[model samples]
Target: MKDVDRGALAISAALAGVAGYVDAIGFLDTGGLFVSFMSGNSTQAAVEVFGPGAAVALASAGIIAAFVFGVAVGGVAATLLARPRAWIVGGATVAVALVAVLAFGGETTLWRVALLAAGMGALNTLFLADGRARVAITYSTGTLVSLGLALAAAATGGSRRAWRRPLLLWSSLVGGAVVGAVAHRGGSPFALSLAAVVLAIATVILAVRPSTPERRPAAER
Candidate 1:
C-alpha cells in the first residue's frame, strides 16, 4: 500500500467525517450536548446552569471531564508509546465498539459517555506529533476557521491549494453528519457501530502505512 503519510490530509479528513458521525449520535442522544466538541458542550453547560438548573449543568460537566481525561490518555499514549497514531486510532475503534455494545444493551450512564468521549479523544491523536493536536478530527470550529482563512488567502491571490484541505475536511464532516442522522434513524447503536467500523478501517490503513517524518505542532490542515 502507498504510504498514508503521503496522504495524511486525506486520511485526516476521513477521520473528521467519522468524528462528525459519532458527534451527531451524541447530539441526538443528549438533545444537544456534544461528546466530541467541548466548546459546544461548554456553551450548553453554561446555558443549563443558568436556565435549566444544576442537573443539566452537572451532566455537561461530567461529559467535559470525560473528554478531557480521554484527551490526556490519547496524548500520553502517543507521546510514550511507539506507533502512537496507529495505537490511538486502534484504541478509538475498540472504545467506540464497546460504547456501541453498551448502548445496544440499553446502557445510558456516564460510563458509556466516558467511553464515547475517550473514543473521540483518541481520534485527536491521529494527527498528534510533537505533543500537539494536528488537524483536530474531533472538532470543526478550527477546521471552519482554517477554511475561512484559506479562502481569504485565496481571495488575496494566494494559492488555492491552501484551501483544498480545509474544504475537504469540512465537507467530509458535514457529509458524515448527514449519514449519521440517517443511520441514527435506524438505531443509535447501529450508527455508533457504523462509526466504529469506519474507525477500524482507518486503523487498518494506519497500521499498514510507513512511519511518518517528524512533525511540527501545527494545526491540522
Candidate 2:
C-alpha cells in the first residue's frame, strides 16, 4: 500500500479501537441496543414499531433517531474538517467526551445516553466521509462480511489475496471490545476512559508528519 493509505489505515485501526470500545460499553449498558451500528438500532426500532405495537415502540424509535442524528452531525463535521486530517481526530475527541459524560457523569440519565449515541453516530459519519475504504472503523457488521468475502476470494484461487489488513481490522475491533467489556465490568467510566486514551493517541498520530501523502484534488490536497 502507498504510504498515505498506510497512514490512513493506521489511523483507522486506532479509530476502530475507539469504535469497539464504544460499542462494547453501549451494548453492556443499553439493553442490547447498538449505537455504532445504526442499522441494528433502526431494525430494532422497526420491530418495536411493527411487532409489539406502540407500547415499547418509542424506545426503539428514540434509539434509531438518536443514531441517525449522530451520523448527521458527524457527516457535517467531517465535511467541515475534510481538508485538514486533524478533523478526523477531532471527531474522535467528541466521541470520547460524549461517551465519558454519559458513562461516568454522576448525573447521567437516559436522555444523556441518547445524546451520547448521537455523538457516536457523528464520529462514525466522520469516518465514512473520510473516503478511506479500510477505515470503516466505527462499525463491524460490514467489516465482518467484507472479511468473509475477501477470504472466500483468496480461497477461490484469485491473486487478489488481500486478507491481512482486513483481518487486522477485525482483530482490532474484537480486541478493543474485549478491553472495553473488561473495563466496563470494573466500572463503566473506565471503558470511556480507555476510549478517550485511544482517541488521544489517534490525534497524536495525525499530528505527526506523513512520510508521503496521497495526492487528492486541489480542493482536498
Candidate 3:
C-alpha cells in the first residue's frame, strides 16, 4: 500500500466499499450465503455439507465457481487491454447492472447471486500486480491481517502511517455494509441498482484518469 499512489488508494477504497454494499444485500437475500466473501462462503459450504445436505453445499460450490470464472475473465481482460482498470470496472458495472435488472424482472435468486459473486470477483482484480491481487476488496480478512501487521511494525518504531491504508479499506467496507443493509430494506433491486451506479462512476473516473503504474512487491522484483 505504501507503494501505491493516493489516487489509486482512493479508488481501491471506493471499489471495496461497493463490494461490501453488494455483498451485504446478497448475504441478506440469500439468508446466509455471501456474494463476495468467499472465505465465509467456504466455511458455510463446509458446514452445510454436514448440517443442511450435499445439495446445499453444491449450491455454495456453484457460487464459488462463478466467482472463479469471473476472476478468469477479468484476468484475461487485464492482460489484453491497454486500459485494464477502466475495462475491468466497466465489466463489473455491467454484471451488477444485470443483477439489478434480473431482480426487477423477478428472476430466480440463483442468477442474481451468481452475478453478484462474479462482479465482486472481478472487482478484486482491480489492483492486480504480478498476477496477484494487491488489494482484496471483497473480503476484509486479509486487510485486517495487513492492518495488524502494520500496527505491529509501527509499535516497533517503523512507519506509523503504514496502517492507514488498510484501516481505510476496512472502514470503507464496514461503512458501505451499513448503508447497504439500510438500503436493502427498500428492495434488493433498488440497492443493487445504486451499487451499479457507483461502479459506473468508478469506471468513468478510471477511464479519464492517467493510468498509475503498479508497483510490484520486493519479492516479485
lDDT of 3 at 100: 89
Please give the distance, in angstroms, between residue 49's alpha carbon in candidate 2 and its true position after superposition. 2.0
| Candidate 2 segments whose C-alpha is farther than 4 A from its true place | 1-4, 50-56, 82-84, 105-108, 125-134, 211-215, 218-221
lDDT per residue (tens digit) for residues 124-164 in model 3: 87777777888878789999999999999999999898899
Q: With candidate 2 superimposed using the best TM-score fit, by how many Å does residue 85's alpha carbon deviate from the native?
A: 3.9
In terms of lDDT, model 3 sits at 0.86
Residue 209 lDDT (model 3):
85
In model 2, pairs of residues that clash are 70-122
lDDT of 1: 0.78
The TM-score leader among the candidates is 3
* Worst window of 10 by summed lDDT in candidate 1: 212-221
Ranking by lDDT: 3, 1, 2
Put down candidate 2 lDDT per residue, 88-164, tens digits, no spaces. Answer: 45565766677676665574355655765665665554334235432466667767777787778788985464666
Q: lDDT at 19 for candidate 2?
A: 71
| Local distance difference test values of all predictions, in order | 0.78, 0.64, 0.86
Ranking by TM-score: 3, 1, 2
The residue pairs in collision within model 1 are 134-220, 135-220
**lDDT, candidate 1, 68-122, per-residue tens:** 8888888887777777777888988998898888897874676687678877877
- Cα lDDT of candidate 2 equals 0.64
TM-score of 3: 0.93
